[model samples]
Target: MDKSAMSDPQQPATVAILAYPEATASVVYGMYDLFMATGRDWGIVTSGEAGPSLLRPLVVAARAGPLLATNEVRIEAQASLQECSSADFVCVPDLNIPPGESLEGRFAEEVEWLRRCYAAGATLASACSGTLLLAEAGLLDGQEATVHWAYCDELRRRYPKVMVRAQRALVVSGEGQRLVMAGGGTSWLDLALFLIARSVGVDAAMQVARINLIDWHAIGQQPFARLARTRQVEDAIIAGCQTWIAEHYCEHSPVAAMVRLSGLAERSFKRRFQLATGMSPLDYVHRVRLEEAKQMLESGDDPIEAIANAVGYEDAGFFSRLFRRSVNLTPAQYRRRFGSMRRALNAGV
Candidate 1:
C-alpha cells in the first residue's frame, strides 16, 4: 500500500500528556510539536489558513495551576486529574519520584485512576522514570516495563512480579495501544512519531521526523532487544555478567574480567555479548549511569555533586557539566523543574 491511500490516523489517538512538576518540557513539547506536524503531513488534517483540527495534544495536570519542568520551563494544564477519564491515550510522563514513597506515594490514587482509564479503553505510556508510577498503579505489576536504566534495580526489587527489562530503548506490550514504554527522554520523540504514524499515516510521521531531524528507522534489531538464541552456554555467561555489573558499576573491569566471570574466552564473550545484548559491556554500563543521572535530576533534590558520586561519578564537577551537556539541563535545574510539585489548592478564601 502506498502512503497516499490512508489518512486521518490521528482520529483514534488522543494524547494527554500529564504535567507533573518534574516532567521534562522537552518530552511534552516535543511530542505535541511532532504529533501536530504528523497530522498535517499525512493529510489527517491539511495545513492551511483553514486546516482541520483532528489531533489535539494537551498538557494536563493532576490538579490545577501552572507546572514547572527541570529547566524552569512552565506550562499551564488544560485539564485536571479528573480529565484522564476522557482521554483516549493517557500519559504519566516523568513524575518526580520522592525518595522514599515515589512509587507508594499516591499509589492508591494512581492505581485506581489507571484501572478506570484502562477499563475505559485508554492506552498508557511513560517516559524516564514514569514507569514507576505505572508500576505503582498495577499496569506493570505482571507486564514488561522499561525505564531509565538507573532505576532498573529498584523496579526489579520493588515489583519482583514484573519482568523489568532495563537498558532498553523501549518496550511495547498489550495489543494495539494498551501499554508502551520509552526509555530515554529523547526516545519520547521516537515513540511520539510512531504514535503519529499510527494516527495520521507513515508519510506524515516521516515528515515530522524530517522536520524534527529525528532518526526513524528499523535498523538492525534493537540494540536492547532480547535475542532468540535460547539458554546456550554463552548466553548464560552474559546474563551472569550483567547481574555482576548491576551490583558493582563503580568498580572498573576490563573485558578479561567479564570473560573470566562468564567462563568464556574474552573473544567469545565479546561476540556473544554483542549478539545477545547489542552493545559492548562497558557501553551498556555507561548507558546505565546516564539513565540513572536522568532519573535523579527529575525526582530528587540532591546536589549534582552528591548525585554524581552516588551514581558512580567521583568528580562532582565533571559529572555536573557532562550531565548538563547530555540532558540539556544542569542537574540542579533539572531537579527544580521536574521534581518539586507546587499546588495552589483550597485557596477560595
Candidate 2:
C-alpha cells in the first residue's frame, strides 16, 4: 500500500457533510467552511507556505444533485454517496421542521448510508433534528444521545431503546468514539469546532474559531430548557398531578398536597409519580421550585436568599446547591448569564 494512502499523519482527512432536502443551510455550509478553513488556514499559519492540507471537506447527498435548504435555497451536492464511498467524518445537519412533524422514513437511504459508514469505521455526527436520522438508523440504540429539547420527548417516545439526555449540549457516544450529537440552535458550530479539534488539532480549531468569532457555548441545555409541566406519560392521573404541581409548587409541603390531591394511596402515588415523571414526588416539587427560582433570578435583583425563600426553600444554602445540581449553574451564575433586570422591570404589564 502507498504510504500516503494509509492514514498518513501529514495527509489531509476527508470530511463529508451529508446534505438533504430541507436541511438547515447554516449547518451544512458552516461545517464545510469551518472544516476547510481550519485545515487550509492551519497550514498557512504553521508553514507560511500552505503546507499539506489537514482536512478536505465535501458536501454529499443521497445522489449527486442539488438539495434544497429550509428557505428553498439551492445547495449543490459536490459528491454522492457512491462518489465519496467513505469519509473520516460524516456530519448530518439539522432538518428544519416544526413540532410534531414526522421525519419518519424521510431519509431512509441516507440513514442506511450512515450505518454503513459507521460500520466501515467513519465517525458519524449530527446536529439538532439530524439526530433523528441517527436514531432511525439504529446507530443510537442503547446509546446516550442529545437533541433539541423541544424534540427530546418525541425522540424518546419513538426510539425507546435510546437514552435521551436532552439537557446536554453535545453527547459523544458509540464504540471507539464513533458518534457525536449536537443539540439545537448554533450547536452545529460547536460540532464543527469539536470535529476540527478532534481530527485536526485544538490549535487549528481555535484559529478557525477566532476567524469565525465563535464563542463556544460550554454550557448544557439545562439553563435554557423549560421543563415540561406534563411529561409524555400516558397516565392521565399523573398528568393532572404534574399540572397541580406546576400551579402550586411554591406552597409549603407541596408534595404532601400533591399526594392528597392524587387520591391514590401514598405508596401508589409515589410509585406512579416515579413511573410517570422519572422523579420522586419530592424531587419533582424541587424541580418545579427551582425552575421558578430561575425565573426570579433572571428577571429580578432580589437577593439569592430572598429568591430561595420565595420559591419555598427555607434553607438558602440547600437551595443554592440544588440550583447548581439541576441547572449546572449557581443562581448567581445563571443571573449573570441570562438575567435582564432592566428589561424585565421596564416591560409594562
Candidate 3:
C-alpha cells in the first residue's frame, strides 16, 4: 500500500488483532470489543447520529479452527492468517505465562505472519508479554521497546539487541512510526487510544475514551509495580544478603553491612549481588526500604519525616526526592492516592 493510500481519510483503516493459544481472553476479546465500539457506537448513542466507523477490527488466528485462551475459553477465528492479505494496524496481546518461560517454538507461524504483515506496510503493536513475539520476529532489534515490568529482564536476556524501556507506558519506534509497544498487561488500552489518535484523530480517540469511561492518559505501570517481587537465586551468599537486607533495611548504610555479611570483598559482593538479583546491593537496599515505606504510607498516619526515618533515611527531603523518582509519585501524593483507613475498611482489610 502506498503512503497516500494509508493516509486516506475516506475509508476506515483495517485493524487485525492476533489470537493464539494461551492468550488472555480478556485482552484478546476486550481489544475487539473496544475498537468495534469506536466511532459508530459512541455517535449513535450520544446524539442519535451515525458516524462513519473509524476502524475495521478482526481477530486473526493462525489456523482455520477454534483457538483456546489460557482459561479454556474458546473463540473461533473470524479470519485466518492465509485470509488476511494486509492490515493498517496489527495488535498482539499478552500470552498468559510466567515471565521467564521461553516462547521459542510456541508460535513460529504467527511470528512469520507478523513479519510478513510488517514488510507489507502494516504498523505493528504489542502489549505486555506480546512484545516477546515482536522480538522473536527480529522487528525490535536495536529499537527501544517496552514490556511488562516482570518480563523486562527476561526480554533483555533473551534478545540482547532490543532496548527494553521498562518504565514507559507506550513506545513508538521504526521509521515512519511503524512499530509500537505498550508496557504491562493493561497498557493495551493505552496502545489502542494512541493508535486511534494517530490514525483517526485525537478527537475521535478522546470520544472513545469518554464513551468507555477509561482513564486513558493518567495511568502508567510504574506506580502499580511492586519493587519487592522475589527472584530465585542459586548463590547462597547473595541469598543470605537478601535475607539480611530485608531484616535490617531500616539501619543506616545497610549495603555496607550486607557486604560485610557476605564475607567477600566489597567488589566481589557487589558483582555477585547484581548477578543473583539483577540489582546492585545499594539498589536492593533502596528497594527494600521503599517497599517498607510504601506499606507504612498506606497503612499509617505517620508524617513523611517519620516514615523517612523509619526507612533509614535521615534527610526527609532527600527521601522524598528519591521516592518520587523511584515510584513516580511523591510521598504525600502516594499516601493521598493509596492511603485511606476508610477505603481499607470498606474492602474488609
List CA RMSD, all candidates: 14.4, 4.0, 2.5
Query: Which ten-residue region of model 1 has the weakest summed lDDT?
Result: 220-229
**Regions more than 4 Å wrong, model 2:** 1-11, 41-53, 97-104, 152-167, 229-236, 274-278, 340-349
* Tens digit of per-residue lDDT, candidate 3, span 229-312: 464468988888887777889897788898888899999988988888888888888888988898898888999999999999
Query: Whole-model lDDT, candidate 3?
Result: 0.84
Tens digit of per-residue lDDT, candidate 1, span 1-349: 1222123454535677777666777777767776555445434334443335346676777765687776789877777667545566666676555423454565565667777777766778787778787777767867888876556656776778778765456687765657888765467766786666655678767767765679742321123222212223446778787777666666655355677888877788888887766578666666567667766666556777777887777898887777655555567765664455321222333
Candidates 1 and 2 compared by TM-score, better number: 2
**Which candidate has the top score in TM-score?**
3
In candidate 2, the residue pairs with backbone N, CA or C atoms under 3 Å apart (3 or more residues apart, or in different chains) clash, namely: none
Pick the winner on TM-score between candidates 1 and 3: 3
Cα displacement (Å) at residue 125, model 2: 1.6
Tens-digit lDDT track for model 2 on 98-211?
646776777777988898889878889899888888998999999999998777877888899999997789999999988999996788888988998999789888988886
Instruction: Please rank every candidate by TM-score, starting with the best.
Output: 3, 2, 1
Candidate ranking (lDDT, best to worst): 3, 2, 1
